[model samples]
Target: MTERARLAVVGAGPAGLAAAIAASARGVHVTVIDSGADAGGQFYRQPADDLGARRPQALHHQWHTWERLRDGLRAHIAAGRITHLRDHHVWLVQRHLNGFTVHALLGPEQERPAEVLADAVLLATGGHEKVLPFPGWTLPGVVTAGGAQAMLKGALVLPGRIAVVAGTGPLLLPVATGLAAAGLEVAALVESADPKAFLRHGRAFAAQPAKLAEGAQYAAALLRHRVRTYARHTVVEAHGGTAHGGTADGDTAHGGEVRGGQARGGEVRGGERLEAVTVAALDADGRVRPGTERRIACDTLAVGHGMLPHTDLAETLGCRLDGLDVRVDDEQRTDVAGVWAAGETTGIGGAALSLAEGHIAGRSIAARLAGTEPDPRGWAAAARSRTRLRRFFAAVDAAYAPPARWTELITDETVVCRCEEVTGGAIREAVDELGAGDVRTVKLLTRAGMGWCQGRMCAAAVAGLAGCALAPSRRPFARPVPLGVLARAGEATGEPEDD
Candidate 1:
């Protein structure tokens, strides 16, 4: 009898979970690693069991799908076909002669090192929010739109009583509606992108009636809560009560016309949290209109500009990237052998796309490991769904893109990199005065991307501010590793034979 081929699936999200289930069912010895304590990723985030709260499914939309995935994972785990390793934060994947070695940090402290050796690796690391900074965004009451949703789903906590959800993405719909449903006062939903753009991709969008219905349900929820929506508008700045050098009052502070008979502008009360946000209308070219500003009083501001695919691990493995996402072939295989990428790492399509891609990859891996060719017909249904979902999301991406001149709203003094406190002025000096033409050069001239986040939060903004195209920064490791882990990698033994 031959030994089963070992597979290491990174991330316990929808993609990773689906891959493990499919592959393991095909007789592969599968191990699933994830940073979260639970199986569900951000999309199916589950509240703590100790919360004693009934009807946790009420917080989620795709209850049936999540249930199936969860049950399948449990069955596989119990049958001894799969091993689940939660709280494993994978930091690096080292290519050996025959296979790969996945090095991860264990637990919340992240000091202990853990390693898993496998014949093949499946990367399902998800995406992160793209945040475009504005003045006063660093205030205490400000949070990412996804961050707000995560808090509500994971901990049942509200960001604040009065919230303003402002962003240019489909994520804003759920965040606003969720907050309103939780009895929080959702002041407004400020969307920078024009809804009219959806007309251009009507054919592609009409192909997915389920997606349209999902969006309509969210719209109805917003209407039920009476959440004021401002399409073709964006938040120019968040005003906190703390005194910074400038006065919060006056037309200049608010930027444009006040709507709904709200106060034009006023001084932020001292020692309080976020008092309000200044939102302005956008022109046809996606530039902000000068005199259409409105001040909406709110205690919290939830903002995000869409998502960026996490390509750090793929880049380290010499995997090709298509635009911002890791590129993979029809079988979900990367250009590099034995490495397959799925989910947001491949592209920012949602959980459904991730699941379909993952299942295809799993079947392909299983067949290839058994020294056989995978018939495309076996996974034709998944492939078809993947195609349709990708097209649907492509339309969504086009319709919800950030405003064209969003950077114009960023004041020279506004801090762009919150990690290193690198301001816009410093970034401009690196480009204008120091001849730093690209994001890398700008990073060298001013320690902007050298912060704790390693440029994850600021890379897009830096590229835009420097007038350069965004490119992947090939990292040696996906996350920061302890010096001990680095030293130990050299001393490890067991060199497997070449494939």
Candidate 2:
């Protein structure tokens, strides 16, 4: 905090770690900041010490790669070239005449606003799960696919005795397979991608039969575990039970939900416990193909549509965006001077691509600092392994790109905004009756995006439901700031605020 660091990397994930090492090796004084206490990002979540997990590597893939990164970080940290700060939740980044200042909230109380000054910055903030809303989705037993995996890997706990993994993307296979491996009775693996899409990209898939074979291994595990697989299907509704806290069961193929009732105004009607679910096949529009509805008896449902980049800091710095991702040239340099981005924030490549991009960006930044030409020989070699993988990912994204007809999935009674308890009907009324065409206008009228999350939860769904463009909003304060802190910083006193 006293002397400004020459290079600052946000996020301790693979990319950030690699970048810090790459820069430090070149003699650039570096500092690494992360929200989690560990160097591994979501990909490498070690169990708590109390758990006594003897072999944490058993729950991870590419374990050797992580070990190398961790060892390198220790060397750099000890050498005095790198300063690693963990549990720092950076909320904003501001440009200064000298370089830039990164602002973050340091602890659970969030009262402490700390600042880090850096001559060059690298943003490797990862991605967050994309949740597509449905009835009973807010129930206690329902969680995201990644969240479920995190629980099994990090806490060594299964979400429920029986689990249903439903969503798009390749993430479902590993999650379901891992749950089954962990002794959970996986009810089903529901995927919305048409199998034919894989065939369409058969050449690319053939080029990397290892990936195909890896997927086959997962399929074999699911089959051995008796976990049913549903293709081109989705969970349209979630029903609890008849009475509050009662058990849930379906009367017919798509009839009943136990502990909770039908999803009404986005709120579950009945109880706290989740007992069953109703799933249906969808046509091209993501609507329930009538007569295809079926019920599955499971205590927990894990569903996630896709992912999006965490681009708040990048956007705040006036970096241009390409489509839904941050735009970066070959070297991963953003338009902003001394600023760079990588990982899912730049695009929706998985951890492997993110690691590669991070290395390239790190080397580029380091070389520039040393007054040498930036060379991408190392990063490009790893990226070459993606000859077939990248194509498959692209196909996967296109096939599952939020069904264009999802607008018809929600009824007026269905709740779209969980925090505000706002229903699909209310959002529709805001557009039709109240003439709320924009996300801000709808937020003002229904308070949909004004909940504890400050719009991260329901903004996209609301925008999609209201037929508005999915755009980001720029705010004065990135996170909740105490009035006292604002006053101490010598900033104007805003009205009363709460987090």
Candidate 3:
């Protein structure tokens, strides 16, 4: 058995990195397991080292903060206080009598199983984008707002040259401006949420001036690039066609190594590439205004409704959840013993809030492992920042909710579940024709959520079409594991569990 208390952090984004550094500083051994090739999670996704990206900071929002975290993590790893496990997809974390057993799959194929035993687990699993389906949503050139950002940051590639960024969130601001700054002609930023609604949460908005300034900066960038902004408008459908002369994306694998080049638009695959998107103004009721439909020519549609917390692992551990997010106390402790959650897993607050929560949780974990009660005053500064930032983002989330009546626009033929090719009409029939009263029933009837993604992409859309609350399916495993891996996961794997 190990003498130093070992903690497992199940992400490497802003939250997990912060927690790992904090815990390591407090004489705790930390293992950060993430699926990315590097430490920075999606928000601070690092370019592959071989690419020699000199200006990676240009693509990130908080470059200085990221630099500090990255440096600290490197220092800790060098000192052997923390172990960084990259490309390990954690499928399930099982609570054991000793502590916890984290079951993960190694490499991209995810055929090989790996296990890590720890005294506690900090879940910073982050979140995923929610893209509501419309006609032609399954087209090749369309990706989530974060997905577009990921392609840019991770692979050093853009989605397309001419793009319409249609989404309703603070995320859209960065994405639209980032694309424009990267030389993509942003045709329009179509936002479904009305700016007028922001006034409702004035006090919450007033709490954080920095966040407001951030939004202002994004708005200014949009203007400098001459990107047209259509307030209270939404994408009705995407149009696809054959395109010639697509920009070659950077650094596709060559001889098992990433080739180096400047970031560029991704090469369009042979299928029909995105050519345009039909946008329409939304009425007071958030329904599309009939006569306001306009077709904007673009090669890509970077669209998203908002975000949903990744709660599969939490559910598997039987952690209490408040609606869609995992429930946590002030120190970011989950209801389950020895489990702490921060970042988007707790809620959809931005990176700063995640950092604060992560710091607090890490400190708490260290104190608990040492068999001592944590002093609230220890993390007082972070707690204050957390409270203020949470208020600020609550207002932002309120103002940026997807168009209230967006479900009304989804045509019967629209593919709601891209994995299963389940259409909106099939979901409606499961609800209206059959006696399906919930998303689970609808899934069973139509196999909408039974695909490889296991309902991650379609749960919200399926719930909306069936007029049911988007409840957690409480999946047994966070992700699908191969039968070979699951058959004897505990007996043999990578290194023996450090129990």
Candidate 4:
């Protein structure tokens, strides 16, 4: 390599930002590309500069850490060690004999092609929310829990005047509190998971006292705001009220998803929106109790089950996966050469674990790129933090498991895939009548996952209804590519060349 070794960090989130700064500080040239207009990823997302937020820190618990990362990145960029490319929607990372070529759409339209050449790549692609379908979920005002948070954080707006935050993961806590803090009338927080179930993992809880205290803080905030929280309760169905002007056909609700049309122009528009939702207590077996049904009125139904790692890029690179997460070794290196992964792409352990893993990956990559053996002792502290957080999150995952019988609660008429307008009944028919036993077969038989999203939003629901694990759908590219971009990709390209 005649020129300095160039590294491409494919996300601007906690992990990618940390890795980029660490590697660049060690003399590596880095290009940080992200789809967002700003450097901060979802966790550190800030209101637009023009918004002139009075106190953006009020929205984040880790604001100081974000300022550190942001300042470091700016410093590196000024010194010519790093470059931040905003609004670059990367669709593929192709390995060449020389190194790698990252293909991306240039802007919001995601049509014009752009490419970046790098000697190595880090896959810090992050994760997306997993929303199980329920009746009336397609109502205009129904949004994901994370989506609601992003709306508040990014756009600095409320989804509705009254909201119900319902989910089964740790993310629901901050989301509900944030909504209440933002002055939204939080009607209730309906959690399907049993709070007592967390006690079963006492060892994990004891190991992370700070995490326990954080939960207590959220509980206190909810109490102070008089936000009703129903433990072991699941949303059986969302109900919509009369529309003033028009009705929505196929409303979408996914957070930090690759798919488009998110942060929807929600109702308050002449669109039909959520008016109320039915919640029911779950039995020991995770089945809903018959007499426990109660209706809560709210204009917004913010619901989520959990989150899944983004592995499309890793899978395309022939990297190994442990379940849905991209598998990585101690240094956060993927099985594939010239590739490293960190953050939620490896697993959804939250920001702290992502930072730890990213720091380790950055230090390791720096050593390797400099042709030196990486000493694990260099990142021993980060590695310890990584291990502890991983253990705690593993227990968290188990404790926050979605209701066991959630699939049975969805009415046949409920739309499962909002992109393609496929219904639960259609998916079930593909299984029972068409004899489709797996997710791919169900997709081919009923077109359940064949929409603009290509199954990202509805894969979990489809797999559950089909009684199968989501088979690795090896997409040629991470997202849909226009025919024009594909045709032009083969022609003489004007990608920046090394000096």
Candidate order, lDDT descending: 3, 4, 1, 2
**Steric clash pairs (candidate 1):** 256-293, 257-293
Q: lDDT by residue for model 2 over 435-479, one digit each (tens)?
A: 998889999999988877767778788888878887876555557
**What C-alpha lDDT values do all the predictions have?**
0.84, 0.76, 0.85, 0.85
- TM-score between model 4 and native: 0.93
Alpha carbon lDDT of residue 52, candidate 3?
71
Candidate 3 ranges beyond 4 A from true positions: 1-5, 243-270, 492-499
Descending-TM-score candidate ranking: 3, 4, 1, 2
Give the best candidate by TM-score: 3
- State every prediction's TM-score relative to the real structure: 0.92, 0.88, 0.94, 0.93
Model 3, 1-499: lDDT tens digits are 1122389999999999999999899999999999889988878988888867767787788889999999999999999999988889999887766788788888989877888888899999999999888898888778888888787777667667688999788889889988877767799999988878898888898778888798789989999999999999999889888765354453232222323434344565676867889999998988888999999998778998898899888998889999999999988999999999999999999899889999999999999999999999999999999999888888888888787898887889999988898998888899999979898998899999899999999999998888888987789898789998787766522433332
- Any residue pairs clashing in model 3, and if so which? none
User: lDDT (0-100) at residue 211 of candidate 1?
Assistant: 93
2 against 3, candidate with superior TM-score:
3
Candidate 2 positional error at 294, Å: 1.4
**Worst lDDT 10-window in candidate 1:** 250-259
